[model samples]
Target: MLHLITYKYNFIPAGEQALHIVFPEQINISENQLIQELASQLRDSYEDEITDIAPAYRTLTVYFDIRKTNYFKFSNKLKKFLVNYTLEKKNTYGRTFEIPVCYDLEFGIDLADVASFGKLSIPELIEIHSSTRYFIYMMGFLPGFAFMGNVPDQIAMARLEVPRSSIAPGSVAIAGKQAGIYPVASPGGWRILGRTPVTLYTPDNPLPPFQAGDSIKFKQITRADYEAIKELDAHGEYQLKVL
Candidate 1:
């Protein structure tokens, strides 16, 4: 049976322990914002019963304790609350951060290829990329890998035709409309343009420093600057300012 909560969503059970609130099939900024707000409301209201509330691109997962609340009663109550939920007129602009990146060939193996693909000079590509402020749409695919969006059209290009076996940790790359840094060494397809020296994830911190809805700006630096920051980062002395 199809259970529609509103014109924009349908609620489906994800087993006896959770429910998935799905939005429109298409990916849009407004739809994502709506999901974020809805997930925030669920967490605020049902903190005791909910074990977790996670929002992805367009779906909100509400995880609850089966021992504390049955799916039937809990889902019904959630549906009713959502039916009356109103998205606030004022937008919540999350924290802004500036990440330092060094785009020298030594760190950016695919830089030449990416520049050629975009029909841009290496300097031109870096200028366009660093000038734009990106929005953090979601953080997944790996721990602390922020899925930021809206890379400039001039520099926006498709991912590599073939995925690389592995990319270095802190490698900054872009694919489609999104850009992100590899927090750990792993296989990926995104075209590499640069690398940041910041440590985005660590066992010492339970959660990543940034969250979804945050804004990020890429600040370009010289290769010398990258090495300096890298040394500080390695020794736990580098500090990234958040506004």
Candidate 2:
């Protein structure tokens, strides 16, 4: 017996040899978890044109093969699955990562300001930021950089008015309602409270340390240790990036 539920879909002719499933607004109810779990189910039930599935803010987009599966049957089956969807609130689909950060002046250019804005001293900032466990909402903008958040309101801040043209890789930053690690060297606007030793965007790597619904923690490390990790990472034989 199917319950009362509704879904809307669109078809796209992509060159990748697969149909795309777009759940744009349907994300608000039960997002990443729903997409991942539901995708597993739908993929198992239907064996056609499924290249990959990507989940974003309140939306899930899947790529599939059009010839193997027509849109009508695909939509019907997906609609039924969604109507009977069983949402699961979970901690992580990937791995919980403990990252080391150096709030030292050499790397952290905005720490003092962030501390001042939050009315906390340097040590207080460290304690507050490191103590709290954050939720990883999604990974985008660049590889390995998880769009994460839910920082306790007390420490939240708005993004920089003028986005920086170049931010060093491995920067750890925060913004309105969220905080995250910078995975690559790129233009960014997030206020950096510190810098982590973790290398997030590794070209040719399929998965980063984070995935949707993952949890991240900040651990304090001395500047010396940060440099040592940098050296080790440069050698390319270390496991700096985790599940």
Candidate 3:
């Protein structure tokens, strides 16, 4: 028996050529996965009409060619598609990446503050943060910035009240239940926990290796290890490990 996936969702016009399929507001793995799957299916099913599809935490923004399909026709098609959509159970899991992060004071400026907030030792805080394989709910803000989630409640710090002028690339951060990395040396604010040595983005190759629906696991490393990996990555000799 085919189990039809059903969830409450609504369509909202973004512009003349685009529209958003919005789901319930929440950061959830199952919901995000559904959005990702829907995006994939839409691309495959309506490739001629769709120019791009971006999946976020609980929304999929679809950009279609106005010449090929108007909002009313496209939305009606999407409604029909949703009525028959069923997810492939076997392909539920996304790719998993093991990224290295160093929680040294110089890189993690807000580390002590987060630890204090959680009433945990720095080591304990690092342990909790690194233990979980965070799910990638979306990728935005920068080319390689992945919005991942469900930071352990013990250290789920909120974002800084004042935005930072600039944030270094590879900075690992947490905001409430979300975790993320700075892909380049530009930012507003998110509580910094550590920094990764891997080069997340480069001008030559703007697109990231991973995509939304993937998973990221941060491995705690020493400062020396961070420097070593940084050198290797800069020279293009290092590759991020994926599981």
Instruction: List runs of model 1 lying over 4 Å from the truth.
Output: 1-7, 90-92
Q: Which ten contiguous residues of candidate 1 have the minimum total lDDT?
A: 1-10
Residue pairs with backbone overlap in model 1 = none
Candidate 3 residue runs with Cα over 4 Å from true position: 1-5, 89-92
C-alpha-based local distance difference test score of model 2: 0.70
> Tens-digit lDDT track for model 2 on 6-49?
44544453444444555555223245455566667766766455
Q: Which whole-number lDDT from 0 to 100 does residue 128 have in model 2? A: 88
Question: Which digits, one per residue and each the tens of the lDDT, describe model 1 over residues 52-148?
Answer: 9888887888999999998898999998987777765435558888899999898888888878878989998888889988878787889888888
Tens digits of lDDT, candidate 3, 1-243: 223345788999999999999999998888888788778889999999999999999889999999999999999999888888887543355888999999999999999999999999999999999999898889888888999988988899899999899999899999999999998988667999899999888889887788887899999999999999999998999998998
Q: lDDT: which is higher, 1 or 3?
A: 3
The 10-residue segment with the lowest total lDDT in model 2: 1-10
**Span of ten consecutive residues with least summed lDDT in model 3:** 1-10
User: TM-score for every candidate vs. truth?
Assistant: 0.90, 0.79, 0.95
Q: State how far residue 240 of model 1 sits from its true place (Å).
A: 0.8
